[model samples]
Target chain A: MSAISIQQIVKTFPGKHSVVALDHVDLLVESGELFGIIGPDGAGKTTLFRIIATLLLADEGTATLRGMDVVRDYKKIRKVIGYMPGKFSLYQDLTVEENIQFFATLFLTSLEENYDLIKDIYVQLEPFKDRKAGKLSGGMKQKLALCCALIHRPDVLLLDEPTTGVDPVSRKEFWEMLGRLKTSGMTIVVSTPYMDEAVLCDRIALMQTGKILQTDTPQGIIDSYALQLLAIGGDHLYDTLQLLRHFEGTANCFAFGDKLHLSLKDNSYSAASVTAYLEKNGRTDTTVEPIQPGIEDCFMAYL
Target chain B: MRVLLFLLVKEFQQIFRNPAIIRIIFIMPAVQLLVLPLAADYEVKNVYITVVDNDHSSYSHALVNKLVASDYFVLTGYADSYAQAMLDIEQDRSDLIIEIPGQFERTLVREDKATVSIAANAVNGAKGGIGASYAASLIQDFNTDIRTDWLQLPRYNPYPVIAITGSNWYNLHMRYDLFMVPGILVILLTMVGSFLASINIVYEKEVGTIEQINVSPIRKYQFILGKLIPFWIIGFVVLTIGLVISRVAYGIIPEGSFGLIYLFAAVYLLAFLGIGLLLSTYADTQQQAMFISFFLMMIFILMGGLYTSIDSMPEWAQVIAHLNPVTYFIEVMRMVVMKGSTFADIRSQFFIISGMAVFFNVWAVLNYRKRN
Candidate 1:
């Protein structure tokens, strides 16, 4: 059975300034597959997540979790899905253990029943089980929320922007935990604005303005770039980018770190040819190389 | 049911964890019941009056003496002219000025009628109105006294006067505290019950923990019941503490069945807590719930006949008081405490509040959408 499937779900918020939050959005995640919804803020990623979690009703379509309709069979859907909202939503006044137990009881399960699933995370939080969740640092709060979300032994987990605001160390640990969870065969659908994290997903759908721009494996998306690209670095990186955008042969020129990812109008322009052109324009110190596209390169190409 | 029990446990843990809230739960009812009744007096007294006796006649003096004699009015001064009376009023020594017209006694003997003008400071309308009515009743008594004293006319028997012979059955002393304590207790219960339900849930909503709960498979009614049961139980604990304090400090005991009061109180709290839950369901923030509950509590207390008699209010206000749940609770309390009224005597109140309980709880639960 497919772990999650959404069919042309449309949702619009009615207000003084009516916003079409979701517009004919659709997706299907295979069982046990780790899928990522990559988008910036207000890209309707959260809206789609909430609908799939059965917390919100779609205005115009249907979603199903493991064959249970999100609208018609929402109760069963709720039992089978673990949803961690975009916001840190654990009770701040509650102790860490209490929050876990509460969420466990909500699913008619117990911590002992699902310890194996959350052992790695809960073990780190054990010393502070007596401490209130609010007093925990950002990383600890994230871990507690994750534990609570997983305590029910859910068949699927929906994590919306779980690592949006965390230190680099914590972000790495969070993905590692996700990697372990993925291996356990529980379907995971997580969203993040970080394009670098997109490569970690088995497959990702790039979303913007309530639309999925593309859905593919990271390498597949990178390999599908049709234009020949060159990475160019020079003595003056900013000046090179300015000249490259207006260059007659330049199709796309954007700064990627210390260099520029430049796609040329002509596939015949080699690194030597571009270097010779920049050299004539007083950018004498330049290094140019043909390079493969990263997920960011593909994302900027689509944008 | 297990989910409900867990939710209830969570609510209690959160409430008990806050020492200040727990302190208030136990202490507030006791303090309010003990302190509020002493100052919440409805019977007006000590209305200061300045009499301008321009007639200077025996009848005018008799009227002045009558005003002085009634405990309701204090004779602040006697002036020969209206200007002096106005001066007395300006000085704030008197709230009212009684101007007996010239030849006040001759007119009564010859024409058989006399007019006395009463002017009162109406800035504080409620106080001023009560004072004026008290003075009017005193003067009416004096007129009757004169007819019996010196007129020598055979008492008219066109309609026999029926003295009310009002027996203030249970509270024979008519202590304001006895009447007000029970009403004040109901007010406190409503405020605590509604505020607890509204603010507690709204706090969760504001902090977004409610979102976590909303996404769960919990039934809507179960969620509402769990939220309400904690505060509902606390409300009754307060009622029990309030009753004990009322008995010990004020010597009040219910003449009616204790079981009936408890039953009515349970239903009253159910209805009130439902109102609180409904408010919170519509509110997305703690501040909004608090202000809305506060506004409703104010209306309930002021119109529920806690410190004011519903009968004395205008017709429209009386109809509104009839609809207010707090008013029914206060009335039932008075009937049970003061009149020893049985449940049979207050079946309407019981049915009305039970209906309210069902209506409000259903409304609250329906409005609380798990799939928001």
Candidate 2:
């Protein structure tokens, strides 16, 4: 059985107009794999994480961690699964050492018993052992929260947007820590809105609104793009974009940083033809080239 | 048990780390205890009076002197007309106005009849009601004095007068502090117990820390007890501080056994702390918890019969008072302190409060949901 399996899970928040936070979602994570759920804000990533963590009940269908039902065997699941909420949930008044000790004790284990599992992350936090969790920098707080979550040496870990709101350098280091934890025979399911981070996961599910648009390895997703993609760059990029939108055989065109990524409908479009077309529209200094698509390009394609 | 121990440690660490909480725990009790009983004095004194003496005779002057000497009334000023004295009442300068008629002792000597009208500002009901009765009784004494002086004294006079001598029980000197301090201590204990406990869990919810607790392996009862035990200990600490202050500062020692008061306070804290925790579960934010706790505290303190007698309340109000956990605690506190009542005296109150404690705590624990 997979470490975590969710089948036809549906959750809706009640209101005058009910919001479907999770609409028939299904997921499977193999043991010892780093899986990521990639989506933007309001994409229901936190709601899904909360459901699998057993903090919430799905409106329909069932979810299980290690083949134990989330609703019926919640007590058994709680023992083996560690959840770090999207928000920084540690007590701000507690010292770093105290926070680790508190969560460890709650899981019926001590830091000393599972010190090896969290030693790497806790090492960075040790210098600030006496510092209150609230007074730490954003990076340090995330690291401390990670240490608290991992101190119990659980079989599965669920982190919701752990690296969000951190400096780029700290975010990179946080992913590296998760990479190491992935190899420790623990099923790690994490979520992030940063599309670039999708490449670091073993597999990723691209989510939009409340539905998963596509789920595959980053390379597999890029390889599955059927349209011919071309990058168009020149002066007056906004005007270039508007001009390209009316161009014949143009399937879809959107700005990607400094270049406009243009896909063709069929063999009727070519790079030379696009360049000639732009120059015909009073655009002389223009560059058109076919480049490999990244995870973001695939995500945009899926959108 | 170990999980509860660690939870308590974490709670105490957090409580002591916040400087504001430390200051509140110690300073609030001292300030409220020192100020509340003194300000909430029931015995009204220094009642400002405006006397409109239309009679310029010695009888009117003598009545005014009696009022001045009684220590209860402070003669603000003597007004020339009844309308002038009415201004004093309207301006809140005087609580009562006495209008002496122009009989000038003639009505008393000739026909043994006279009249004096009293107008009191009933805005402050206690001061006005008590002050008016004091003035009327003083005038009655003056009337008897005049009649005695006018009549030929018979050494063995034959009018049978029923004289009733009464002894004040529980409080010989009728010290208001003796009556008020213990009840105020109950309020202090209630504030520390209920208000603090109510806001504790909700604050965690606001800060998102409750999500961590919800996802953990801790049992529901263990979590509830963890939140409760710390405040339960704080309740005793506040009670101890109040008792010490009452004994040293106000010179009030419980006439009954200290064991009985502590026993009652222990159960009382559990009942209301359970209420505070129950409120905590229902509220999503600390502000909501605080407002709901404030509403309940107002009802508990007001209907608890601290300031007014439960016996004097309306039938419906009396029912609410009996239903209130605070009413029983206040009654027991007064009984133990003022009347020196033993366990046997307050046994029914003890059982009722114990029942309330069980009911509130069981309800609170069952209502607190880890998943929701």
Stretches of candidate 2 above 4 Å error?
Answer: none
What tens-digit string does per-residue lDDT give for candidate 2 at A189-285? 9999999899999999988878888889888888988888999887899999999999997888899999999988888778989988988888989
lDDT of 1: 0.88
lDDT of 1 by residue, B174-246 (tens): 8988888888888878877799888988988888898888878777877888988998898888888998989
User: Candidate 2 — which pairs collide?
Assistant: none
Candidate 2 chain A minimal-lDDT segment of 10 residues: A294-303
How far off is each candidate at the interface, as Cα RMSD in Å? Answer: 1.1, 0.7
Question: What lDDT tens digits, residue by residue, belong to model 2 across residues B214-313?
Answer: 8888999888888899988888888899899999999998899999999999999988887888788789988999899899889999999999999999
Error of 2 at B36 (Å): 0.9
Model 1 TM-score (2 dp): 0.89
